[model samples]
Target: MKPMQSPLQHTQGGTSSGHRAWSALIGPIGLAMAVGVAYFLGARLSLALLTKPDGVAVFWPAAGIASGTLIALGPRARLPVVLGVVAATIVANILGDRNFAAGVVFALCNAGEALLVAGLIQRTFGREFRLESLRSVVG
Candidate 1:
């Protein structure tokens, strides 16, 4: 004879059905802000690090690597983080130059780099770090 799982226990394995609607709206909304901030900060940090050198203008790509790795490995919010960051970078470029060409390049290259890194992480790590795993380990 097996014991029946309580409703709470059964629902705890994944996101709850009731919260699915809330997640639909809030998840992307929150990720956008986080990605924007991460991208901005990542780019700014790279720019500052490379400011002393001349003829080295790969700041956006380098920042993408850092930001992407952090987003993909540091959290499970890789896609949203990268998207938000790329969008913000494009917007910043357009604002600065009033042209979309450079922005497009930056967005595409950064996103590509991020995707590559994310794929590599997924392959290397076997699986993403999960909240339940952490909880079990901690408890």
Candidate 2:
């Protein structure tokens, strides 16, 4: 015989669900560093080709990477993703010879945008989100 899960438990993925254990198992630093390195590489690659006259990429893939990192890792990853995004953004811009102040500002903007998009996805699709509905695409 097996114990029954509550309807809410079956529908929602949160602390009592499987995802939290990964965060606990990996610990905070590991997650941050992994996301940071991935973001940094992604930013660097995009900058190499997409940079405009002002040193800004025409399309910043790092923002998508950060947002996807947060959404996939769930709510627990927001801080690490933010740190990764900001650090990666500033470093990539600096390496490309952008002004320090501009890099700082750009980093903040990139982080903010990723956070906002991730929040919207979390709201629309829940923590364990899926691409199951038109709302996910249209919204």
Candidate 3:
């Protein structure tokens, strides 16, 4: 008699269960790293591009990075990515002499923007969607 294989054991393309588990664990870590790097780069660029008395940048690079990350990571990675963004935002704000309340608010806005972008992309194109052409742009 043949032995029954568990669902997890039947990994796609013969990948091992241990490998899949490691990848699952690493995905969030990579997201966190990406968020941190994006935040840092945004802060530097914002400081360099400061022209107004309010010190706001003409382009917030972190916003685009966060949105792109959320889109690429998919729905399953939302929580971790949001948490990472919040942490990065708060740290950046505090280091830049901003208050905790402001940091929290800004973090919330950043998170909300990422969620909105990700949800729109997912809803408009489904999970297997790709921004590959003019149709994707139009959509």
lDDT by residue (1-139, candidate 1, tens digit) is: 5464322223344567776556655665676676676676666555445544462444564455444445444545565656776786777666544368888787777767776665655555545534356542342
2 or 3, greater by lDDT: 3
How many backbone clashes does every candidate have? 0, 0, 0
Which residue segments of model 3 deviate by more than 4 Å? 1-23
Q: Which stretches of candidate 1 lie over 4 Å from their true place?
A: 1-18, 45-55, 58-78, 95-98, 128-139
* Number of the candidate with higher TM-score, 2 or 3: 3
Better-scoring candidate (TM-score), 1 or 3: 3
Cα displacement (angstroms), candidate 2, residue 60, comes to: 1.6
RMSD of each: 8.5, 6.4, 5.9
Measured by TM-score, the strongest candidate is 3
Instruction: Assess every candidate by TM-score.
Output: 0.58, 0.73, 0.76
Whole-model lDDT per candidate: 0.59, 0.75, 0.76
- Local error of candidate 1 at residue 116 (angstroms): 0.3
Q: Rank the candidates by lDDT, best first.
A: 3, 2, 1
